[model samples]
Target: MRDPAANNGRELARSPREPPSVNCRLEGDPTPMQVAKRYRDATPESDRLPAKKARLLSTNTQQLGTENETQTKKTTLQQPEPRRSKRSYASFLDDFADEALVHRRPELLCTFVSEWLESVESDREKHCRSDSHLHPSDEQPVARLRTRSAPVMVKARDIGGFTVPPTPSSTGPPSFRADLDDDRSRSSSSSTANVRNPRYRQNNLRFNCIHVRHATSPLPVTLSGHVDSLRAQRSSPGLSSDDLNQAMYRIDVLAEGCDEEQVVKLLDDTVFPDPEGDDTFGPATGLMSNSSTLMAQHLVPADGASPYRVTQPKPDRLYGYSERTVGGAFTQSQLLAQTMLHDRNPDYTTATSRGLRFPFLAIQFKAVGGTRGDLWVAANQCAAASSACLNAVHQLNISLQACQSTRRVDNLSYCIAVDNKLAELYISWREDSSNYYLQQVDTFVLSRPVEFQSFRTQVRNILDWGKDARLTQIGDALDVILEENRKNAAQAAKSRTSPPDDPAASAKRQKPSSRRNSKGSQSSQTQICATNPTLPEAEAG
Candidate 1:
């Protein structure tokens, strides 16, 4: 008999390895086997890996799919992937219906369906051809339609109107791979994609609507109430008329030729006093100036080559605590359980000191002579930063039980784009889980002492509110979420450990089977599973 080790050595010594049996390349990319063959051809035989090592490596790599004489392996064993936590289109529709009922805007839902149907019909007409081939003349129209649909779908999805088609299974046929590739290409061009160049107008349509609203445009009741409360706040009693005069004088002197750093220093000294410097402010407040420290990766827009890579917002002035000051302390086991259940860090989605938990305010400051263009750039930065802040709260809300009434509160975050001359206050809120809105509430000419004072007062009020009201709200919500989590754990444990039903009792307990009801219930359960797998079976029951 031939030596088994010699046969293995001969196999490993072969010039070109057999390629994977799967037909069709990935987007026309070279297969791994082809690349390996090329590398082997270029390298000298003497310089190649030792025959024993190469054989061992090949055997190890192919072990998942390699066949023994007893059976011909047709499939590789793979660890099952975790199900994605994304909510489904049906759940989105339910939320939309609920929102419409609450707002008494039933017409909105009708309009949404009509618009979607119209677009779909138009798309079908453009693509349909007698020869079953697209005409060159129709290409531009089809392209335009696709371009328009991408944003529409992104916006609709954000607002709970768009539906994502079901993803192809991993074990699906080669034909299914084509659909997956098409989806990947389509998503790349969508507004929902990770953007490298963060343009305010180009990337954020909802944000644009908020910033462009007319001065007289009515705001949401909750938002308007917060705005009014901000306006009602009085200026610092410590800041007397003399203090205002001196600050204004200093600002006027620096207004002509100050750099960004000088402007930041001037404001820090005169207008926005350091919270830590004042004993009254205590540890409740935190300030980070010109720090390029990165926030949580998921919280910010992905702008790097890798989707998971961190993006730094690096606002001029960041005002928020480094940690949550309220909420019940979690034991180690409870923290571990939370980590396993939600795949969350114990930091509550915050990464570092610059994470700025529950940040209510951010400032993007420029030099005195900064142009309107410069202010626009600052606004973009502020918008990105403010969105991250809102996202942190939204993630926390996701952890709460579905039965909870209050998951999120709006108008909790605000940003200011300011120079020595002009300052604009923008309030940030979420219409739903994904739709983030940032609207300009007020503008102030810092050159004028009255407007400057008004600006200072509003900033102070926002900080105070964040420290007290916002923190309390967040703390209460966190406690409730933790309590719900505990309850869920206990119930799960009980279900697992409770004694099995007695067979004698079970036989006696059996009732007349209602086939109609049984079918209906099973169908209902199937619908729930298909549309919302994230929902626990216990909850569904």
Candidate 2:
């Protein structure tokens, strides 16, 4: 039907290398031929090939493109859109999380500080005694030298600042022997008058009704008095010469510039050595002698003005207070004190299953290259922890006083700061109900043999004291309080059962004990600062 001349003209209009243009209706999908033609036309002329190669390339491209498009469509249809949910109340609070004051407004910070300082001063005035309170004979010696020119070295005698009086001569005058014989005969006759079972004494320690007598009008005074009294007394023998030599050998093994963790490990190994294999350190004592490096998160922070988050004290090691060590004597009282005596659980309550409990001895360690500033920081931590221990005992004292018990608790805690070069011992005690005090006892250089042995001896003695003397003191106080409580309860029940007409019963009923009436007010007096006492800083080398 076409003219020969028109066909020739169409052939001439298209180049022999160029693919033909695609022709299709716009409303529906195009045919494969049309698609191939579209792709070929859009591609560059240089990319176009002749013969079978051009046809094969177009077919492959068309097949891949179709498969990808179909896969994408299927994915889109199968997946549903994510739903939007409402925001939480906490999410709304995020905007003002950083704000401290009301509505981000500032006030007089100086006024707040001044008022706090005044409260501290007033509290100190209540219980702390003035320097005039100390008699000339009771006065403590000047502090030991801590100059950078020479490393510090001290012994137990220097630390306590007391001389042990020469042992009383066993060989006295002839009359002394005659007096002793007479006293023995009189004691034997008195023993026959009253027959009672002899109490078992552990380690021959005097744990009977023997009491430490105080003045007739004894009033609670600052902790400095307690420390000074302790300083004036003779200290007990601690580590043997052999033990000191062994510890010194271990210390000498430590290299210079050791890290903190290394120092901790070395000190622990040197002081509290692990028994080899399972042979055991003697028999199973069942008492927890020591614990180490556990976080004290349950206690309140000592530094309230920290710009960042408050830090919990994690002492390198703790000695002499555990459930087993106390024999659970304080368990019930600790729980009762949580609700009755304190605003919160006392700082000594760690609230952990296996944590250091009411630790009497705490230690802090820094790297070998640490400075005196670092040691002071460690001292501050020790002060806070030691203060907590004293506060716990002080709270018990308050409870006992309420029961009309004459017993009073006056105890001290010890802390040692150890670093590459120096070991500094510090003592902390409750000065009064509202005040506490801390003072450095002694310092020793680790590298030196003489000083290190002294340090070792002192530390061992403290550990021994905590395990025996201190434990007995705390246990006795708890037992006394429990006994008083029982007595009061029995008296209360007896009065209730007495005849209504009885004058004694009537008098008792009419006048309720002031202690019982003022129980709620005790919380106000129980408040005490757990911060370290400021120490005069020695100049850095």
Candidate 3:
């Protein structure tokens, strides 16, 4: 029933006898749907870039960040590198662009850009000092390089520039690869995430970026200060500050084909350019440790701005603070600080809340007189104390400064601490009624009024004394005796029972000898002769 003409046309299309132009419409000049499908397929591969680049760009000095990198998700971080006093970014980029164009590393070239015109994009205080070593995959084709982080200001010269060459490689270090083959495994963008144990190896890294721009018109005092503080410093191990110097040389080349107005236009075009924009420069990240540190420098009262949200942590766990007191600080930086604060439960008073009964850390203040017991003077009186016989002096002090309290008497303070590497345990406890103790219920609570002295020592001692406090020694709590009692009940019941004896054996067969039997009824015995041949009369005494 089909038309011959239609059949012939379909056959022609499949047979490869069709014209090339028709084929182009079907495949080459893709429809939006086809383009979208390709993009979907390409994304996994796209995510691979950061993983490879992160491993690639990191020096031994930068490697310490690797431990945290895997646990975090992609986010933008603001990195406002101090700009050099006499440097011109416009001139520098123009020159850098010409060289990259010559070399043709389009991927890197396109990403290096200034999107400042589009508000650029809402895009490291040190603790310890140590040499950093970047670990590579054990499966290799390379060498190792050792490096360390040091602070320095890069100087931007006041001149036209030339091309800067790539610094020699610093690939010597240890061996470390994310266990997950796909480094981009953590693509989920959730507000909260469990902080990874530092020992875990993560392939996924949080990618953060930001851009900076300044006017070419005239130099201002504030801008000068910014530039002077932003330059790269020289290191003896790998690259030198001169490499940044050479970046200026490339700027001269950027100025070659263009005039001042054109340079301005280029800078303007660079702002928020499409994905394919020029790539000599970009919003650099990991240029500093994290976004919060950057924000504190920019938004904190001293950083010269009315308070703003510019530097807040990305809405994810890897870069967050646990305590509201620590506020929006990065979780890593706040770990130690957070550890020092009072936990959700200061005591086992609320058996239901975590940390209640979980071991605490005690810091007994020695300054207050022993008799006054530290908190007495602070609270101003003894009878005024809240709990009877409660030497309980709960205070809230950070760095030993007394936190104000409405409590008129002995207000003691307490805090917990953790290991220095931002490694910590958020100890929480749950009362298990199914087993023994009442689950946050009224039963089993000691009859005595709550006492604070024993209380203060209790939690701190648990953590301090550790498992020893929790260990069940013989006859400790009555519950152990009760368990033993149950088992004994079954054993006692079995031992007390006995079986009845059988009556049938030989006695029933001997019934015929009745007359000769020595026994007789009580009346016959009284008569003394009926049942037996002779018997003495039984007399009542």
lDDT winner = 1
Candidate of highest TM-score: 1
lDDT by residue for model 1 over 119-215, one digit each (tens)?
4445444434552445545434434244444443332232444445645457778888889898787656553433234543454433333233444
TM-score of each: 0.50, 0.42, 0.15
Off by over 4 Å in 1: 1-200, 203-216, 235-238, 284-290, 301-312, 324-348, 351-355, 370-373, 401-408, 504-541
lDDT for each of the candidates?
A: 0.60, 0.52, 0.26
Question: For model 1, which pairs clash?
Answer: none
The TM-score between candidate 2 and the true structure equals 0.42
Ranking by lDDT: 1, 2, 3
Candidate 3 residue lDDT tens string, 1-541: 3454564455446422111111123322442223334555666855756755565466554666775674453353433357854323233343334432324344333333432212122211121223122323346424755669655845443334433454435544333234332333442321122223221112111111111111233334543442233222222122134633443343345433433333223222321111112231111100001111111111111112211111221110111111212221122322233233344423211111111111122211112111212221211111111111111111112212322222222121112111111111111111121110000101111111122112222332322222232212111221322333445666677656743444764466566456456455544565656556455545410
Query: Candidate 2, after superposition: displacement of residue 391 in Å?
Result: 1.4
lDDT of 2 at 126: 39
